[model samples]
Target: MVTVPTRVRLGYAVGSFCTANFTTIPGLLLLIYMTNVLAVDPLLAGVVVFLPKAWDLVANTLVGQWSDRTVSRWGPRRPWLLGGAAILPIAFVVMFIGPPLTGVPAALFVGAAFLVAASGYALYEVPYKAMPAEMTHDYHERTSLLQWRMIFIAIGIGMSGILAPILAGDTVEGYRLMGLVFGVILLLAMLASFFGTANAPYTGQAEPEASLKAQLRAARTSKPFMWLLGLSSAQTLGAYVMLAGAPYFAAYTVGSTGATTTLFAALVGPMLVTMPLWVWLAKKLDKRGAMILSGVLFMTGAVAAVATPLFGPLYAHLVIVVVGVGYAGLQLLQFSMLADVIAYDGMVSGKRRGGVFTGLWTAVESAVAAFGATIYGATLAIGGFRESDPANPVTQPQSAEFAVLIGITVVPAAIILLGVLMTFKYDLTSAKMSQVSHDVT
Candidate 1:
């Protein structure tokens, strides 16, 4: 087994801090920013949230292909990491610094900014996700490395998820301040990853595939990867749907905006403390078994949360802690599984196509994350949610409050439950992976 340095593990994991902040804050706040602050209709706000990420379906793939063929002093991925560090923060700040406009015009402005931000994020994320497979060849080591990432993910999500809402509050100026503060944090995290991974190993040194089509064809033909993608994408969609609904659930069902912080703390706190436990679970059950257990845990929590109206906010918070336990497992295992697939591909095909695979993974993930917000927005619109500005604060109807409850609970639970079928279909095991590695060596 090849061992990775603590610095390399840390450098790579820190990049997740950037990813978690960008992904969580937007899914958490952007839709409400539109519906509440900009006075945009719920459905329109959902569209605005969803549309830009749709561009990522194409852009992330192209960036992945580009990074695969890139030759740089900084290496294939770091150059793009630097590019993202420079551009994404600017676009992110622009996304939330809601201009002096309302309705469709405001939606249009955010969408445009978000489009650019999505592109910038692709520049970083696709290549960043590809690195683990290249950094080390050991299957279990991939899990160990990603364990650090989950820790950072927890911290990053915890900090951003809890604080961003407080910083933004319910006004235009509040959002701008939130944007600037997080934007700086984003820049620093990205740069830290780029500089930190300066001396990491890169063992997957095969020549790049001739074209994106060829690389994607390779990924499509990999059964483990395809199954993993389907289930993982479903898991992402469910998690983000709940994330998008958190603020609404807190404000309407719990009757306290401050509950957002408490809820996030509940969700992320387990992730910090239980990552080692998840790593151990993966070892005992293998990645697929551990993932299935985690999904069940997540689904159970979501279902139990539906009773929050009966039990109150404390009940909702406690159930989410259960969800958080499952979330920690899902987050760690999915990427570790992906790393296994990528490494298998490198050994079997002898091509440097990790970027392409990761590109596809990140693209589907980003789009699904956005769609989670869109789905929640559509749910609110269906419940006849009223949009209003701070100047005219609107109290949501009973139906709207119910919509918040269901969106945060039932919708995600159902989505995650559906993903279990795909998880069952995934067949990669440690023995099989070990054979593949032995064959290659």
Candidate 2:
């Protein structure tokens, strides 16, 4: 019954620039930056990427709990959003400022900057994710708001995915400029959200839980939330594996680094155009059905891409467009479902615990995303990937090229298919939500 204002929706959606840019750029390029630019071993590069984000397991939960208890004029969430806006950009810029060293030293420097950046990212993301449930109780309105968010996410992913590579080139200096450019973008987007939601409405804010353990205990009891978490974690992992392998797929598998931008463009273009169609489909199929269809599409693309060696770059780009279509739906529905679970919790339990649920959601999402990079890195290691720098470019072994193809294709396809199967466990239909609303109201 509640309809969010268009200005508020747009304000909230703009924050996706921060979320999408931070996650996509690193997942898409950081591993390559280490292996190809810094001359770090593939396995070591993966570890460096993984360890910093692993910290999110702790930081996100704490931030969530902290924000839940926060008493601020800016509201519980916006203060942290402001903090993250200021800090993350600086840390992000530092992440790719390009250390004057290589190997372990370079890895350590980048790792430290990333750890700070991860902390800053958690500051914003946990509370930001918690907002929609608090914003409105209407299920469809949440989806509407998130539709706007996904559009921005698509734009953010598209711009960064397409341009960051071009900006970073294959050299250290290029990466430095890319970092500065995106950092400013991150700052402006996050601040816009903080100010844009200045007059946003809140449906309700319940009393905070006694402790983090108690909050999480309450969250664990929600079957819908649990199932959603499992489903999203698996989906994120599979997607990021493909993302991590993208550069290698461009260079070695497609025989040109320029393909990275084109590949990402293919993957993001559909996300921009088809979001409304997916949202409409969800009305007919229900969110769960739409989710399954989207997963199938993603799996189909990934499976088809395995034959890229036979079909070549044009085929690779075409299939990636399929993956992009599915991905748009997946990204929109996952958080929309999370908002449903959070709203349901407030109704059933009489407490505002969105932060706890979102913290867990973000922690798992961040970790698994990083883990995807590690998985691809391990695959590259298995194929005996040779690390090199711009000064001394080296030809990759055929085995490494094979690893790139399989890592980007079969591994992701299989993992995403399993996620699709897990969707059956999610039983939070609109009918169920309508019944819950009737009972609560």
Candidate 3:
């Protein structure tokens, strides 16, 4: 029997914080880097930002499948984790350093570095995500594990969001310093997780003889998994658009770049404070109910945020606080729900195939990010956004504002609403998941 200590669990969560730091910094700052510092056209920058992540759509799934069948003395997942800890940080530093030459040469260098970082992220993230399913078979325990994990995720987001601006100083040096800081923290976190968490013994539960095609076919046929994938992909797009566009809106629309820090603090602060509330809601209403309620709040808040220009900064900030509350619930509960889905798949297939599922999950997430960047980047192009002049009178060109509004509110709200609709298809209630746990064990 494998027992997960509270300390070990906490260590895993902290490790996730480190691993996510690389991605969070990029997600929050990449657009700023391209447009403001590098003088890339906003539209073109968006494309550059969007395309590299799209590569993850393919990479994440392939890495996941490979990890699942891997056999080793240190176990399958940890080796990848250890390896990524070393490689990802170096890639992250190189990404921010930019290329030796100017213009296209620089852009190509940045893109190539980002590709390497994404691969490293997959190396850790797929196995990290899979651990929840493999660690315990209990339904409530899965929720508990995810809840813990999310707390750390919030920490990562908060640190990256709040500190990146402060550390980076100017756009150019700030990105470079932020990369170095995040890379160091990531290494520390991975080492903690490696030393702390004990792997659950493999029970010969994976089908050693199963062909890759056969496993893919099985995953393809899973209806519940498919529905979750659809919902999650849409949600990813919504979240990414907000992340990518918020800084621009803060600087140009609100007339305050500091507002970016304030907004992020409002968003993540609630998540950290009210995690217990979200966990309770999950327990009382169940994951699907909690998700739907959270989605509604997210939609309401997003719509309200879009209207900020008309309402003025104070009112807009208030609306954002409200939205943060909703975001807190949705973000926490979604991963918990994902853990449940993985367990359900395991029960039905009679095989532990977490690597494949996590891989696919991460792939969809990366793809959605890519898609959102495409939309955001193209919107900037269409709107004629110029990044160099923070105070460019042209920054708020009617077309640009329209694009920001669409990216921040209209499109995100629609996507979130779709997520709510899809929640109805998640048939794995806690009770059902509990039953599945019993049978699988």
What TM-score, over all chains together, does every model reach?
A: 0.99, 0.99, 0.93
Give per-residue CA lDDT, model 1, range 46-156, as digits (tens). 988888999988999999999999999888989999989889999999988865999889999999999999999999999999999988888899999999999999999
Per-residue accuracy of model 3 over 1-441 as CA lDDT, tens digit each: 344568767867877776457656777777767676766677666677667777887888777778888888867777778877877888888888765343455566777888888888888888878777777666677677767777888888888878876786445666778778877888888787777665543333555325666656766887777887887777778777777777777776677888777778877877788788888888899888988888888889888887777887787678777777887887777677677777687776777677887888887787677667667777777876666622332335778767766777777788888988998887778888777767766
Estimate the lDDT of model 2. 0.93
Q: Per-model C-alpha lDDT, please?
A: 0.92, 0.93, 0.74
Q: Is candidate 1 or candidate 3 better by TM-score?
A: 1
**Residue 367 lDDT (model 3):** 62
Instruction: Please give the range of 10 consecutive residues that has the lowest summed lDDT in model 1.
Output: 95-104
Q: What is candidate 2's lDDT per residue for 34-69, written digit by digit as tens?
A: 999999999999999999989999999999999888
Residue 368 lDDT, candidate 1, scale 0-100: 95
